[model samples]
Target: MAYTFEILETEKIELVIPLVYKLNNGKIDKAVLMERFSDMITYNNYECAVIYDGSKLIGVTGLWFCTRHYSGKSVEPDHVFIDENYRGKGLGKQFFEWIYNYVKDKGCEAVELNTYVSNAASHKFYFNEDFKILGFHFLKKLKK
Candidate 1:
């Protein structure tokens, strides 16, 4: 199977949104997706890449470039998603390798991403890809 990574554009937003919604397990609302798409278009310091099998969008991944006083410099993978049908076909690894190489070429010292503790499969994949677990991530939910 052949795969290609294309730089995401506003024209492909519709196709990308559904895959992202599926990856997030339907937790994200359409409104939020639209808002984020707008933000992605307006933000010049970030990069978004989508994987395609022929003409169909199958995966999406990206990172925001930023520098912090305490953390120094780093790039964070905002969202990484592979379509259910494409999972386990070695596409996820390709996505991460591409992201790592892209970030390294852009002079980022490190890349970071967060996944829920319950996602054991993801944990194994990340570990196999050589991503070290630094520590725990604590979250505080705000009542709406």
Candidate 2:
């Protein structure tokens, strides 16, 4: 199947909120997702990549660019998801191949990301893509 991809600009990020909702399986309200995406866009360090088959959204992923002391400039792919209708079709691999080239063209020396420990499927996918475990991704949420 033919597909199109774009790393959406801040002004067009609303296109991604719905897909993010799907990624979260509706655990978070769409309104709250929109709000969080708005905040992230405001930072100007994040953008989202999406795959579309004509008018239908097939997948979405978040790309965070930053200068890490350890990795220098890097692109972190977050919340990667391909629609259930399209999974196991090599779309995930192609999507990440596109992302890898995109970030490398932009001078990213490394790529880093966090995935839930429970997401064994993603861990397998990432490993197949040659991503190695560097260390634990620790986190502490703040009171809001």
Candidate 3:
């Protein structure tokens, strides 16, 4: 299958919102996700990398480019989700390769992400990709 990779414009974030909804297992409200996406695009400087198999979206992931004291300019990938039917087909490795090259061209020194602790499958995949656990990702939800 021919695949296309694109950096989805901030204004076009809604294109990937449904895919992200699947990432969250449909637990969060779409309205809430929309609001979060608005904030992410407007204030958080979020970018989304998407893969399409001839106009049908197969994978989506959020990217944040920033300067971190420890890593200089880095790309933090978040909420990475490939369609259920598309897993185990090497699409993810291809997607990451695309993202790595894309960010490297942008002068990114590293890639970081926070995966849910309970996502054993993600842990395995990231480990296979050579990602290491540097520290815990603690969170305190102030409001919901």
Candidate-wise lDDT, in order: 0.80, 0.87, 0.89
Best of the candidates, lDDT: 3
* Model 2, residue pairs in steric clash: none
For model 1, give the 10-residue run with minimal summed lDDT: 6-15
Looking at model 2, residue 21 earns an lDDT score of 87
Error of 3 at 92 (Å): 0.5
Task: Output the lDDT of residue 116, model 1.
Answer: 73
Quote each prediction's TM-score.
Answer: 0.86, 0.93, 0.94
Per-residue CA lDDT of candidate 2, range 1-144, in tens? 988878877787788877778877799998898899889878777888999989887788889999999889999998788888888988899898899999999999999988889889899999999899999988899999
| lDDT, model 3, position 109 | 95
> Order the candidates by TM-score, highest first — what do you get?
3, 2, 1
> Which of the predicted structures, 1 or 3, would earn the higher TM-score when compared with the native?
3
Per-model tally of clashing residue pairs: 0, 0, 0
Can you list the residue pairs that collide in candidate 1? none
Regions of candidate 1 where Cα sits further than 4 Å from its true position:
68-72
lDDT: which is higher, 2 or 3?
Answer: 3
Model 1 agreement with the true structure over 8-46: per-residue lDDT tens digits: 875557667887787778899977997888778677777
